[model samples]
Target: MLNDFSPAAAASSFSPAFSPPEVSQPAPPTFTSPAAAVAAAARLAPRLFEQAARTDEVGGFPTQEFAWLRETGLLTAALAPALGGAGLGEPAAALALLQVLYHVGRGNLAVGRLFEGHVNALLLIQRFGKPAQVAAYAADARAGHLFGVWNTENPAHGVRLNFLAGGTYRLHGAKTFASGAGHITRPLLTGALPAHHGWQMLVLPADEQPPQLDRSFWRPLGMRATASFIASLERLEISADCLLGQPNDYYQQPWFGGGAA
Candidate 1:
C-alpha cells in the first residue's frame, strides 16, 4: 500500500524530542500557482539548453542555470503553500511537478535530474522530518539554498555515522556519485549507523565543513555537467539537529519504494 504521507500522518509520527522552530519564517513570495511555477521554468528552458553544451566538461556545473532558477524562484516552488511555495510536490499538484521536470529535462537532463533530487529531498523532509526540521529546511529552500540528496556510496568505504555523547555523531567514510558536489550547499545524505541502528539521514551543510571532493571518481559517459563526485566526510562532527528523522526512516515503506518509482 502507498504510504499515508499527508500532513496529519507526518505530525502523528513526530517524536517528542523535536520541537517546533522558534524563529518565525519571513513572509514568502506570494504563493506561486502550479501553472505559474511551470511557466517560469518553461521560460528558462532555452537558456538552460544554451548553457548545457558549454558545461559538459569534467567537474562542470550549471552555476548560471541555477542562478537563473533562483532568480525565477523555482527552487522554493516545491514547498507547500503555507511555507511560501506553489505546493508542487503535494498530492494535489503531483502532475505539475512531472510537467516541470519534463520541460526542464527537455532543455537539460542533468539539470532536470538535479532539480528532481532537490524537490524529492524537500518532499521527504516534509513527510518524515519533525516540524522544526521541516520549517528550517523550507526556509533554506526559500533562502535559495541549493539542496540535493546523496545516497550512493562505495561498498567498502560507505558513509558511516558513529554515535557520540550528547546527540553528536562522528562520521567516517564518503559518498560517491554525489551530484553537484561542490555547489550543493545543503545536501541530504544517508549514513549507516552502528549497533544495527540502520541508516540515518542527515542534513549536511557542505559549505561549512567542506568535504574532501574528488572529481576524478566521476567519469560519466555523458551528462558531464552533473558534477557527481566522491565526497569524503571523514571525522565530520554533527549535532542532533542535523538528523532528519528517526533511524531507518529513509527506507521506510512506500516513501522509499515510491520515491524510487
Candidate 2:
C-alpha cells in the first residue's frame, strides 16, 4: 500500500531525464504470434534475473531490462494485431500474456511487476480510450515509452478532480503506492470526482512535469525497484481529453474483472 492519503513529509525525488521521452530505441520486432511473444519473454527472463541483483536496492529500477523489452517488441505486444502487435490481451491470446508474466516474475518479481503494469495500462486504454487516443498511445509504445497505472491513494485524502473551465480538471491530493513513480512517462491515474459524478480515470500528458515524489514513503521489504512511492499531483490541470472513460468506467468489465484472466 502507498501508506495514507494524508501527506507524508519524508520523501525523495527522481526525474527521468528522458521525459517528453526522446528515448533512442530500435524499432520493435515483428511478432508473428502471441506464442512468439511468450517465447521472447521466456528467453529474456533469466537475463533479467541476472540483473535483478543489481536493481534490488532502494530506488533501483530495471532500466536496462525495460530497454531490452522495448528492443524485443514485447512492450507493444498487447496492441491489436492490426497494429503490428501480437494482440496479447484478447481472450484467445490472453494466456500467452499470462505465461510471459509468469516467466518474468519467476526470474525477477520487480521487473515482472512493472511489465505487468505497462501491459495492463495499454489494455485499459485500448479497451476504454477513443480511437485517436488508442492510436496516439500505440505510437508511443512503439517508440519505447513505458506506461503505468496509479490508482491507490491516501485514505483520508484520496486524489480528487475538480472540473474547471475550458475542458480542464484540476487535480487535488496525492496517490500513494504509485508504482514507476518517476520512470513511467504515461500513468493512468484515478481521482475522485464531485460526489454525484463518481470517479474519473485520466492519463497524465506525456510531457507533464514529473509529479512530486516523497521518497520517504518508499521503503518496501522487496521490489524496491518498482519505485512504488507517494505522488502528489495536487493542483495540476489537465485537458478534458486526458480523461479516459465515463465517470467510474475504470471499475467496469474486462479490466475490473481482472483482465489477465
Number of the top-ranking candidate, with TM-score as the measure: 2
* Residue-by-residue lDDT tens digits, candidate 1, 1-261: 012112122112111111122345343354459988888888889888888888787757777777667667788888888988888877778788888878888888888888878888998899888999999888877766778899987767788999898889888887877887777778899998898788899999766766766666666755878877677787888888998888889998877876676
Over the stretch 199-230, how does candidate 2's per-residue lDDT look in tens digits? 88889864564577876677776688898878
Kindly provide the TM-score of model 2 when superposed on the true structure, using C-alpha atoms. 0.92
Q: Clashing pairs in model 1?
A: none
Q: Relative to the true structure, how large is the alpha-carbon lDDT of every model?
A: 0.76, 0.81
Over 4 Å off, model 2: 1-14, 17-25, 259-261
**TM-scores of the candidates in the order shown:** 0.85, 0.92
